[model samples]
Target: MDSKAEQQLASIANISNQKERTTSYLALLSTLFSSQPPSKDALITLGRHFVTSMSMAMVVGRRVLGSYVIALCAGTSMDTTGTASITLDDEGSGENQQFMQAGINAFKSSEGEEVRRDVVEGVLAGGNLSGWCEEQTTVLRHLYAHLLQLEEDWLGAAKALMQIPLEGGSRLISDEEKLAVYIKIVRLLLECGEWGQAQTYFSRASLLIHVTKDKETNLSYKLSQARLFDFSARFNEAAQKYHEVSFDSAIAEEDRLQMLKAAVTTSILAPAGPQRSRILATLNRDDRVHSSLPPSLSTMLRKMLLEYIVRQEEVKEFEAGLEDHQRATVEGGGTVLERAVREHNVGACGKVYDNISFEALGNILNLDAENAENTARRMIEQCRLRAWIDQPLHLLYFESRSSHDTDAEAQGTAGGLGIENKEKEVEPRLWSERWDDRIRETSIKVEALAEQIQQKGLIPPIPA
Candidate 1:
C-alpha cells in the first residue's frame, strides 16, 4: 500500500456514515490480509501499522474498530466447537525464524490474543506459498518457541494468556473456556483488590450467561460481582444484584437466603433514613424470611445489636432518661425517715427499733459518755450485727432535734439529773450527724449494687 492509498483509507474511515466507516475499515483489512504471496516485510509492516491505527482508534472513540483490529491480529478462531488449533512448521531455516519473530512482535504489540491469533491464522491459512517459505516457517516456529519461553518464565501461561484481549475478535474460544478464563482473572483481580478491573471481567462473564443460557453460572457470577461491590462500599449496586439473584426461581432457597442476608447487611450499613428503611422493609417481606437464622448468624446479629443498642454510651442515655421517672417513684423520693415510718406501720417496726437503739448508739457514741451511754452503745452494736448477719432490713432513721443551745434551753429542763441538760444538748448534734452519715453511706451502697447488676447483665431486685 502506498501513501496515497493509506491516506484514502484514513479518509474513508473518518466518513460520517457509521456503516461506511465500518465497511471501509473491513475492506481495508481484507485487502491487506488477502494480498497473495504476502511479502514478509509487507506483513510485518502491516502488523505495525494496524497496531498503531487501532491504538489511535481506541483513543479517538472508535472502540469497535479498535477491537476489530485487535481481533484480526490475534489468532482467535471463531469455532465454538472448541476444535481450533494452531500448528507451526519447524523447517530449521532463517525464514521460519523471521516469521516467528513477526508473530512474537504482533503478540507484543497488542493486548488482544484473539486478534493476534486471527492475524497469524489468516496469514497461515491464506496458503501464501511464498510466505510459508522454509525461512519464514523457521521464524514462525521461533516465535512460538518464544511464547513457550514466556509461558515458562511466568508462573504459568496464565499471565501470557491474560495479556491477550479476547473480546474484540470474531473467532474466539468457546463460552466455557472464556468463562474459565473470566473466573481466573476475576479471582486474581479480586485477590489484588482491583475491584474495578474485576468488575469488567464480571460484566463480560455476565454477557456469556445471556449467550449460553446458563442461569446458574450467571447467578454465581452475579453473586461474586455483588460481593465485590459490597466490599467496595457500593451497597446499592451490590444489593440490587443480590436481590436479582435471590429472587430468581432457579436459585436455591439457601442461596437466596444467603444473598438476602448480604443485601440486608449492606443495606443496614447504608446511609440512615429512607434508603435503609426501604431495604429493611423489603427484607421483612422476603418470602424466605425465617423465624430464626442459623446459630452463627444469629450470634452475629445479636452482637451487632449489642454494639448498636447496648453500648455503654447508649446505656448512659437510657439511664438518664429513666432518672426522672425514677425520681417520681416512692423508692426515689422517700427519705430514710419516711421509709422507716412506713416499715414500722407495716409491722416491720421491730427491725427499725432494734437497728436504731443498737447500731446507731454503738457507732455514734463514745464509751466516755457514761456507763449508761456505753451500755446503750453495746446493745446497739449487738442489734446491728445480728440484723446484718440475719437478713436485710429497710428501716432507716433521721434525727428530728436541733442542736442549738438556745433551742435546747427553751425546750428542756426535763429529768431530775443535772447532767440531763448536757446529755440532751449533745445528743441532737450526734444524732443529726449520724443520720446524715448513714444516709450517705446507704446511697453509696445502693449505687454500687446497681452498677454490679448492670455489669452482670442482670436486673437488680426492687427494694421491698
Candidate 2:
C-alpha cells in the first residue's frame, strides 16, 4: 500500500475500540492542525478521508471533538475575509460543496451552546469571508444571530446580521432574502434602541417589500416601519402604521392585540391636530377599543377624541403602560407622552372656551403660566392650532377653524372639493366684512343728520 494509505490504517488501528473511532479520528485531525499548517490540498484530502467521522462526531457528545470539527471546517487561522488557508477550493467541485455542507450540517445539528458559540466567534473573529459559498455562510450567520438573540444581546445580533453581503457577494440574493435580512436587522436594532441604524435598514426593506409575495415578510416590514416611526417620534405615522398592521389576519391573535394596543398608545401620543383627531375618531369607534383594549387606553382614546381634558390620574395610568422610548424626554421639555398630553389639553381648552386666561390654562395643564403660554404659542406658530395669544391681556383666543379653511390656503383653488369648500368658507368671512361696511356707512349718515339738525336750530347745542 502507499504511504498515505498505510498512515490512515495505522491511525485507525490506534483507536483501540471501534465504537470510539469517530472521536479518535477527530482527535487525530486536531493533532495535525495543532502542528504545522497543512497545504490546502492536504487539508482537502484529510477532510475527504474523515468527513464521515466529523459528521458523526456530535452524536457522541464530545465537546473537544466538536471544537476540532468546527476548526477543521471553518478554520482556526482565518484571513481578513474569514477564509482559512485550508478552505474548500473555488473550483465548484461536488466534493468541495459536499465537504462544506457536511460541516454546516454537523455544526447545526450539534446542540452544544459552547460549540455553537465557538463556531460564531471563530467566523466573527475574522471578517465574513465572501469566497465561501453564500448559502453556507448565510445559514451560519443566521444561526449565530439566533444564539445572540437567545442571550438577549440584541445589538450583537444585529451586528452579526450586518455581516451578510446581500447585494455584493459570491452569489446573487433574491428580494425576499434581502427583505428578510433587512427586517431582522431593523428589529434587532430597535430592540437595543438603535433608531438611526434601524431606520437605515428599514429604508432598504421598504424597497423590496412590494417585490415579495411573502405574507410574513410583508407583515414584518410594516411592523418594523411602525417601530421606527415610534422611536423617531413620528407618532401620527406610527399610530397609522400600527393600526394597519394590527388588523392583519396573518398575525397571531395575541400579537394582533398587542399591535392594537400600540396603535392606541401612539395615537394618544400624537400631536393634537386634525390628523390625530381623525385617527382618534377611528380608534374610538372601533369595537375592539372597548372590548379587546385595556380600560385605560380605551378611556384615554375616548377623552382625546371627544376633546375632554385629560386628568393627572388618567395620564399616570396611560404612562404606566408606556414603553421606555414612549416616556423618553424630548426636545423643548418633558416625556413624549407628557408633551402630547399638554398639547391635547390646550386643544381641549380651545374646544370648551373661545378664550382663556394663561393662568387658568396653566393650572389645568399642570404647567406654569409662562410655559402654558409658550406651549400655545408654539402650536399656533406651527399652524397646528388655529388660535392667537394676546400678550398684553395674557389670554389665548381660540379660532373656530375647519379643514376646509386651511385646505384652501395650503392647496389653493385647484378644482374639485377645493373650489366648492372655498366658496362655502369664503362666504361667511365675506358676510362679516360686508356687515362692518354697512355699520360704518349707517353711522356716517346718522352723524350728518345730527349736525344738520343742530345747525338748523331744530335741536339745542351745548356751549364750548
Q: Model 2, which residues run further than 4 Å from truth?
A: 1-111, 128-134, 401-464
Give stretches of model 1 more than 4 Å off. 1-161, 164-180, 203-210, 247-256, 292-464
Supply the global lDDT for candidate 1.
Answer: 0.43
Which model scores highest in lDDT? Answer: 2
Provide the overall lDDT of each model, using Cα atoms, as 2-decimal numbers: 0.43, 0.68
Model 1 lDDT tens row, 94-168: 333333333344444335343443344343333322311222322232233234333343222233335433565
Tens digits of per-residue lDDT for model 2 on 1-464? 13573477357746656456654554555444442233233333343333223233333323323333354345212222221122322322233433344344443433434454654456444542434334445555666777788789999989988987777676667677677788889999999999999999998888878888777777878888899999999988999899999899988999989998999999999988767866776676578989998898898998887778999999998899999989889777799988999999998897689999999999998889999999998887666776767678898978775654443232223332333222222112344664586599999999999999988998876779
Point to the candidate with the largest TM-score: 2
TM-score of each: 0.30, 0.68
Supply the TM-score for candidate 1.
0.30
